[model samples]
Target: MRRKARRRRRRRMRRRRRRRRMRRSRMRRKRRRRRMRRKRRRRRLNWRLEKRRRMRSRWQQRKMMRIMKRWRRKRRRRLRKRRRRISMMRRRGEDNEEWENEEEEEKNEEEA
Candidate 1:
């Protein structure tokens, strides 16, 4: 009888230890899942930020292109007018007429 009671006590102690180990393993698995979720959230946020930066750069590029096109057009018009005025001055041989025409062009430019 004494030997049987001792065996039963040892068996119960082993069962308790196994239960504690199982509980600890379960907690570790829960922590692993939380870490995975956090990593996924960070990746999602980084993707969004990258997308926003791309869109902003594209918008800036488009805006710069528009401004460049406007400047090119204005430059082309001024160059054409300057060429016409120089030709007219060579034909007329008068500095006053060239100056007066330049002033008139300024009025047209202001209207535009």
Candidate 2:
């Protein structure tokens, strides 16, 4: 009977140790899940930030394109007027060296 009791005590001790190990493993799993959830949230926030940055950059590019188009139209109109003036000066049989220089400069600017 004493031997049986000793065996039972040993079995009970082993069961308690097993239960403790199980609890520790469960706690570790919970901690890992929490850490993964935090990482996912951070990734989601970063994705949103990146999307916003791209949208802003695209908007800026569109704005710059519109400004460039407007500038091009204004330059063409000015060049047309200068050409008309140069033609009129030529018809009047006037020395147009200054106008010719200006026209050459405008052409160079357009080439650039």
Q: In terms of TM-score, which candidate is strongest?
A: 2
Candidate 1 contains a number of clashing pairs equal to 0
Q: Could you give candidate 1's per-residue lDDT for residues 14-64 as a string of tens digits? A: 999999999999999999999999999998879745555565577776776
> Candidate 2, residues 20-111: lDDT per residue as tens digits?
99999999999999999999999887974555556557777677667778999999999888889998999999886898898898899789
The weakest ten consecutive residues by lDDT in model 1 span: 47-56
Cα TM-score per model: 0.42, 0.46
lDDT of 1 at 101: 77
Candidate 1 local accuracy as lDDT? Answer: 0.80
Question: Relative to the unseen true structure, what is the C-alpha lDDT of residue 82 in candidate 2, on a scale of 0 to 100?
Answer: 86
Error of 1 at 38 (Å): 0.4
- Using lDDT, give the best candidate's number: 2
Whole-model Cα lDDT per candidate? Answer: 0.80, 0.87
Candidate 1 ranges beyond 4 A from true positions: 48-112
Clashing pairs in 1: none
